[model samples]
Target: MKKAFVAFILLIFISTSRAAKVTDWLDSYNVLWTSQSKGSYDSMPCGGGDIGLNVWVENNELLFYISRSGSLDENNCLLKSGRIRVKLTPNPFINSGFSQQLNLRKGFVDVNAGNTNIRLWVNVFSPVIHVDINSKEKLSAEVYYENWRYKDRPVRKGEGNANSYKWAIPKGLVTKADVIENSTDKVIFYHKNDAQTVFDVTVAQQGMDSVKSKMYNPIGNLTSGGMLFGDNLKFAGTSSGEYAGTDYKSWCMKSVKPSSSHHVLIALHTQQTESLNQWKQGLADIVKGIKSNDDKKRTQAWWNSFWNKSAIRINEKNKDSEAWKIGRNYQLFRYMLGCNAYGSYPTKFNGGLFTFDPARVDSTLNFTPDFRKWGGGTMTAQNQRLVYFPMLKSGDFDMMTSQFDFYLRILKNAELRSKVYWNHEGGCFTEQIENFGLPNPSEYGWKRPANFDKGLEYNAWLEYQWDTVLEFCNMILETKEYNNEKIDKYVPLIESVLTFFDEHYRMLATQRGRKVLDGDGHLVLYPGSACETYKMAYNSTSTISALTVVLEKMIEYSAADSTKSARWKQMLSTIPPITIREENGKKMIAPAKLWERINNIESPQLYPVFPWRVYGVGKKDLDVAVNTYFSDSDALKFRSHIGWKQDNIFAACLGLTKEAQRLTSLKMKDSELRFPTFWGPGYDWTPDHNWGGSGMIGLQEMLMQTNGEQILLFPAWPAEWNVHFKMHAPKNTTVEAELKDGKVTSLQVYPAERMKDVVIMIKK
Candidate 1:
């Protein structure tokens, strides 16, 4: 018994040592800068709990732009709250000795210069922003709340891209001014939407006016903004200025008395109500709920627990190597996603909440900081799916709620679309849809022919693109498979989306021919599209794969109920086999059985290898998928590491080590901007989230891939690129392993029985 006790104590010491090594590895990736920023382009991201701020020190002033989730305006544009500028009488930031760092583990930004030190952090549990400053000598401080929308401003020719109107702006459309009030100790501001918003116009444009009252309108009577208050500060006066070609007004405040320490707080509130007094009360309540002494400790604790969940570290001893950069950037992007974990809505794919001034992204636009290319409330399912899929492997199951709930809240609006237009029984979600679940008015076409179908968007790139929503349905079911999460709330949503394809396609078949199914008793998938690329197609492989996989999972999930399982089994049978053709005398998956025109640069032929998981390392027909990757003409021409592209993902899934390494390296390469992960305006906007998301997915796939009961490790990972990773899998399992010198150095599997199922693919 004495010997056994000694052995147990030794094991505990060894485990604790190993855990410390992992945490130290993460600390090395923290971003540090020795010089001040030139502009917002060089800013560092800092935020939590659905709030995002771009922090920078320029021209002896510390500045940050505040942005919050669910702050949609009358035009359905997601607006920035305001900007805050901080200056000190003795201006320590003007000195040559300066440093700014993003502390990833504690989730805050730290800046130091001369004798002053500043720390900025947002509460992870509440909507509050905190700034703390300490100096050896007592110093006065000036705080400025800047607003660019102080007057009704006309959204110029191309500026409409920032809102729902796009290029089809209605006559006399302008961004309304925000109301600001200044008192001795605080300045309160907010933007309240007009009674009529884009939601109303979209409903009438889509011919759903009769059922408008029953629809859900997220922008109607909405108000969003916050108050600026501090411990020893009082309002000074007002001033006006211009920044980056835009005009603005400022409400100024000054320190009541110089002190060695200063603390400032900005409490933000957003609500949808017709009473302005009610909105003011909500803002006051946020300020009243502050527990300053406890909030910082709690926020830091949340970040610590978050980093402990999962991590991927590569070539830790060599920070200069490309392998190390990819791993570091992966964690940095994940930090950005974590900032919006509990958002009322899912993070936007175009830029999320980290976008900066438009002039910084494109010098020609010269628009406000609120300017992003794609409309604010527009949710493109194809791009949005890539943003959320990587969360599954990282064991961030709780973050998935924002996305799943976004669809649940809009389910009834989608169903109403089907009933009002086609008198159908399932939801009809378009490719480019609004927050209210209607087709974007511009994409729905202001010049539609009288006889055209009201159920379809007039844009060619978006027509017949209803299959993208199926990916979300699959993500919902995957959460249950990966984490054993309770998904009872989303079952109705999944059933409705699946039912749409089944009944709507059958109805189309009946209208054209006598039988509802093809001669093979399969659903006649005509008038379809393969990801806006293979247009006017028949039996699109993407649609077929989506229907087959979702139905099989749904049938398995509903096995306890005989009636639902039987119905889904019948629907599963009607999904046609994935199309294949002979290319250079080798079998390769086809985009569709037939197609008329190539509309865009996307290779949907590899759909079976990825999200659907029809072909992979542990699955059959591996060579056939490999042939398509190397030999398919369209795939070769379209392969790239640009925004929203998934070729790297395909290579990883097929276990093509050299190809996967080459493509993912380009995808993860540092951005041209000062911040390495502020990726691109490629095919979207700066800090393209889908670009980072695709990179995240590829790196995860290279490390591990799961096929039902089997988990394959290092399937596509390079043998010599030493790595330490912790990743989640199906059946509530986690695998933590270390690889060095082309061999597995250590392996730990939770729920020991799962150890038997893990197959080490790399050579020992």
Candidate 2:
């Protein structure tokens, strides 16, 4: 008892020595709004689980856009659940002395105006949103459901860029009018997909009609419904409006609670149901589960643990400085990712679950709220990885399952296509594909003149780019290193992904008069790509690096079975070596062998520096990696701290401390939105998650890095900056460090024995 008690005391001492409360810093940066803004762009975002709300005060009325993840309609378009507007008997927001804030610690928004104050929160464990209003005196309130899609709206070819498949989809794919209804005192609305959905159209176009029955379809008979209920509220019929070229309708409810406080609950549910009655029942059940006080406690408990997981803070002493903004924005961006923690689909890279009106983002687009840059039907793997890769270092492992399972669910369909197309046995995932592992219907270029490669993409940027899944396979392996829970389930996935490269490349080699076993027995990767750049190349660095790293991990995990282990070991040796070339008398990593054209700005050669980590600070090939970053012409031209940016990552990997700090600060700086995390339209859309993801990864690597069993503290951190951070590393270890004024004031490592592996980079 004495020994155990002493150990516990020592643990607390070690933790407190280095780490302060994460919430202490978070509290200081909470978003506060004192005045009303012009449009939805000025709104503050709040959400929990899979539901997100854009809350703002405009035209003396409180309004919010309700969006739930994976709410697809008949067109395979992700749609907004709807909008809600609230009005007080006497509007306080119109007067001087009104304030709104997003409380980061509690994961909710608070608005105070005149005599009334409203607290809005989405339940973290249940699909329900709450609006609790309290006033100094008794007040009457009117809540209304505002829906712009009250009638079928034709999806045009050129709407806001977020409509990923709109142009490719057939014209006249109209969004059916939302079916609005009132049951007793409740006002509800839902959008149900038609019997023939975009999924059916895509399969028929792709010549997969024979096997369409076996494909996993998420659109048929799909419905998304929302219900609003409160004891004080009574249904007050409906109203219509035509404003700003938009025709819309609203269901009104008037309420006057006896007391000063009014509580209203809104429950949202999306399902593949047989009928509207089933959806109504599902919503009723959700409300019943969350209407009690106990559920609020459960939701708060989940959020409390979420905020406690891991955090990073940069202290610049000047709150308004760019450095402070970087740190605050990092946390803010992470908050958006957390909003979809329990989503059925992985958060979309274009906007995740928080996209607002399209007209607000781009005035010329003038599309509905559902419009975003990329379509809902397609998940572009290249941009998609940027959204989830940073979760590894942030220790948000639980949140990663949604993405991993996304690919797993589509694995069989991908494999079937490979077998049907090339008589091959491995799954073939393309750069842009539907959720079911088929290439996007419109992007597949089925109308090409003649003799085109049926398996290759007509778009130069996406052709021969099937290896991005390797990054996710590495993510799974890394997750196991941090926690041993999911290994058994992911092992097969890792094996199959690696096997595809081996089997498919061998088949391609035979047609080029190159034997699979010829000249070093390496697999010939002709017609390959170094990212979207270096098209029509052979033996690309990115593909080889992914093959080498993923196979090594697969062999290690599958060692118990000799056959599986040997197959992976052989495949690793058969992957072509990463190319090196001399440019301006400096040796650098080459994009690929026999490179021809450059289509995009991505630096595929430096990929070895990242995702694979074959060359980095402590690794033997550090000089080569550093030279690649400095001398690569294309890399230098494309480098920016914007959406899907990689310069910060390369700098950190090369131990270029000052460069890492400068680039990371730029990448993490305020995204120029009223809400700082809504980053970009840079190569994607507003609130570009890939941009946020790249920044998150860069900041994480600057603070903590792992090479095998050795942990490097502040490996790429600059000397002038003071930082406090706690981040997870491989092998069930966490390193917490505090550096103030160039001194290593405090440091702590979990599982003290791992301290032997610690390499402190900070100078005394």
Candidate 3:
């Protein structure tokens, strides 16, 4: 009893030593957004739609609201088909020592800006733009939701989907502007460019649609008016006429909550000024709805509660080391990933959360941040797998399931399509594809490539991706889930995946008569040019790692089913061995090394190290991988995406941690708003790019080792972190451990650690 209590106190001491909090000093409504300030550029957009939003942080003792500003146009729009959403995430920061208690709160939205900064509260449902502006001075507020249509009212249009065709802000609607405080009613006019008192009456208004119906297109649907889809709710509009000899515009709103489930047209707008009127009014409305302190308080409490669930104790002395930073970054990555994950499509590693279509690129109006799929760049299979990484441990699994289900359908559909197109020979699923199962137009052009018609991404089979899905499928199944047929169905799919690899390769003699996959030198020849060289040469690392994992899992599963044992074992041997060749003193794992110029996309080498199980050789070859990772020739290395260019940050962190060099991982840490919401290469580092790598923090196989089936607690914890640490392993759970002055102090496991014959080692 004494020992256990002593351990608990020591754990508390250790946890407090490295624990830190997120410093949220600003609200989304405080950053005065207007036309002159280009607030639209800072907002989330609808893919291929032309609308934007500028989030301003408005907060005080009265209320806290995210003042949204901007409009629909050729660039950014609130396309009706897109879901209007607001979300919050918490419990993200990981400490080096032990777990810390935290609380989290629910987040609310004040769609309009002119509200009391602190006293405001929002209901469950919000119209696209409701809660209007009624005052121009301190303590005044508004209640409204608004949207505008095309400027030159399309002559061909009948009442589109909206009640008013004249939704655009005509000159007469520009009355009753910004609100002020502590003064007689003074007109707070829009600032032409903040710091002045003027406005742009000519500035256009926004158009809202419940669906994305383009009027002109050769490939997509050519519907003009719009669809009656969205969070199909009700709405109200006010008279746009002279009032008190000035001007007046009103917006009436109804519950936007979906009756069934569809879309709706909503107009959002902001006045051209910043007095306290809008803030006060917004706050007053929120106050009326409030039953608690404020949104901030609630949000903070929510986040705090979440953090308390799991604490990441950090070794402060190891700060600035890449290993330490990677661990920290993993936490940050999950935190960033946790925020704003709402939409039919998926999150983007590209610029916009919904920032689809880069307005103009390569002299053409191209949509980059797309809605029908996870846009930015292609390869949803890899990135999608990564995006869901946070779910296995710390998240509501619904979104994760949605994303996985969508992709699983895509994979199955591709297979079915391949059976028809390739006559069941098996070979489809592109290296990159849209979330909607459409091949990328830029890479393959408007027509689906004849090779791709069979469903394979690269003409060559991406055997790795197939295995990755199977792994995920099994992960879901093994959790003792009730509805596990979803996993069972995928098992057969994986079996087929192995069959394809079995049939595709032709064995040939290489060094010492070892069997080698002959890209038939096709990669070096003509038709092979299409396959990425880096992926074409040697036995691809991704492939071999995947094959190994697949084979191992299949062998385990078949062990219980005698009928399939022989067949599974026979095929397992056929899976190729990873090719590790020496190049200039560094170890190089190749896809087969047959092509001339390896495309930058070939980064499967690290599969064995991470996402795959490969090697931790004691030689200098690790240097080769690291050097080549940062090698001058690596195209992605110089990309502006700060950190993610090199895929090895996590691996490197792991490697360093494994080597007990906590100093290296500490240096590469990145942060968002100084709270450790980290990720450097924003575009290149997406779901897995950012969050996938973040998984390193939770499953720290490097520091807290996991070999075979046992757990190795603190295999690489730095001396400073000896003060505190908390972690858990599968089966019989949680472990609270601590150290002081480079020596072990105490260790405790909750619910007891022995689940099976699983070994638990306290390594020296």
Candidate 4:
């Protein structure tokens, strides 16, 4: 018994020692700089709890652009809350001893110079921004609330891209000014939405005006912004200036007296209310709820828990290696995702909440800091799916709620589209959908043929692309698979989405002929699309795979009662089999059985190997999927590591080590920006989130994959690249493993019974 006790104590020490090494490895990835930034483009990201700030020190002044999730303006643009500037009287920032560090472990920014230091952080549980300053000598601080929307500004020809208007802005469209109130020690500001927002225009444009009153409008009476106040500070009047080619006004607050230490707080609030006073009360409530004594500790604890959930560190002994960089970037991008863990809306794939000025991204487009190519409030499921899919393996299930809730909130609106248009059942979600669950007006077509279907988008790229929402539905179900979490709230959404495909396709078939099913007793599935790539397709492979997998999982998980399960099984039987054909003497999956034309560069043929998981490392007929990856003309032509590209993912899923390594390295390489992971403007905006997300998925897939109850380890990972990783799998399980010199040094599988399911593919 004594010997057993001694061994147990030794085991505890070894476990603690391994944990410390992991923590130290994570610390090495924290960003650090010894000099001031040139502009916002070179800033570091810092925030939490749905708020993101582009933080930087420039010209001896501390400046940060504040952005919060769901800050939609009258034009349906996701606007920045505002910019805040801080200046200290005896400014230490100008001193030679200057440094700025983003401590990822604590989720805060630390700026130091001479004898003064400043720390910036956002409360993870509250909508509040905090800046704490410490100094050896007494110093006065001046805080400014800057707003470029001080007066109504007309959006230029190209600037309308930031809003829902895209390139089809209505005449005389203008971004209204914000309201600012200055007081003795505080400055409060807000932008209340105009009564007539894009929701009203979109309803009329989509021929839904008759039922507009019943549709959900997220922008109506929406008030967003907050109060900036500090200890021992007094209002110092206002000033006007120009920033990034736009005019702005500032409300200044200066310290009443010099002090050795000071604190500043900016409390933000956003709500759709009938009265402005009610919104103000909400903001006041946030301030009153600020538990100063323990908020910081609690926020720090949250970040700590976040880091401990899941991690991947590669080549820990060599930080500069490309292998190490891939792992570092994976964590960095995950940090950005963590910033909006509790957001009301999902993170945007274009830039999320960290976009800077447009000029910085494209020198020709000199627009405001809020400028992003894609329309704000528009959810592109094709790109947005990439952003949230990686969270499952990383065990960030809580963050997935925002994206799931987004669909739930608008389920009624989406169902309304089907009822009003085709007089049928099921939710009809379009590819480019607005916040209120309707096709984007611009994509719906400003000038359309008189008889064109009002229900379908007229644009070639987005028309008949209703299948992308299936990816999200599958993600919602996977949350239960990975964490065994209750998904009662999402069951109705899943049923509605599946019902749409079944009923709508049947309705279309009945319109074309007498029978709803084809000669083979299956849905015809004509006029369908294979992602935006194969248009006017017959029996699209992507659509079939999505429907088949989701239905099978639904029945397997018993997400529904006996009656619903019976219907799902019947529908599953009707889904057409994924089509495969011989290309150059090699059997390969076809994009579809037939297609009229190709519209984009996406490769949907291999999608079944991925998202749908019909064929993969351990699945049947893997050779056919591998043949498509290598032999298909469109697949080869479209292979790339650019934004939203999934070649790396396909290669990983197929267990192609060399191919996966080459593609994923390119995807995860350091970007041109100072921040290593701020990848792109590839096909969207700078700090391309989907780009990072796809990279994360590729890396995670290379390391681990699951087939039913089996866990495949090092499926496609390079043996030479040492790694320590912890990833979540189905059945509420987690696998943590360490590999060094092409050998497994240690392995731990939660719930010891799962050890039998682990397959070590890497040979020693």
Answer with 1 or 2, whichever has the higher lDDT: 1
**Alpha carbon lDDT of each predicted model:** 0.89, 0.80, 0.34, 0.90
Candidate 1 deviant stretches above 4 angstroms? 1-22
TM-score of each: 0.97, 0.96, 0.56, 0.97
**What tens digits encode model 3's per-residue C-alpha lDDT throughout 429-514?**
45445333334323323233444432333333331233345435444443323122235645665566566455434311332234
lDDT of 2 by residue, 1-764 (tens): 01112122222335423345566667877899888877788888899998889999888888888989878887767889888888887666666488899988888899898888988999988888999989887778889888888898877667623443545645566778988888658888889887777777777766677677777777789898788878789898889985345678988888945458888878999989778788889988887777547766777677666766778777747687777788888888889899999788889998888888777777787778888877886788888888888887777899999888888888887777777667888778888788767887667765765667666667778888888888888888888888664667766667777777878888887877746655877888887888888898799999989888888888888789899889888888888788889878888899998777899889998999988899986788688888888878888898888888878988887778888988988878777878898988788888899999988888888877888888877778876777778788887777777777765666677767777777766422
Which candidate, 2 or 4, would have the higher lDDT against the true structure? 4
Better of 1 and 4 by lDDT: 4
lDDT of 4 at 567: 87
RMSD of each: 4.1, 4.0, 14.6, 3.9
Q: How does residue 707 of candidate 3 score in lDDT?
A: 49
Best-matching candidate per lDDT: 4
- Per-candidate clash tally: 0, 6, 133, 0
Candidate 4 at 510: error in angstroms?
Answer: 1.1
Candidate order by lDDT, decreasing, is 4, 1, 2, 3
lDDT of 1 at 61: 90
For the record, the alpha-carbon RMSD of candidate 2 to the native fold, in angstroms, is 4.0
Question: Which sections of candidate 2 miss by over 4 Å?
Answer: 1-21, 160-164, 242-245, 256-259
TM-score, model 1 to reference: 0.97
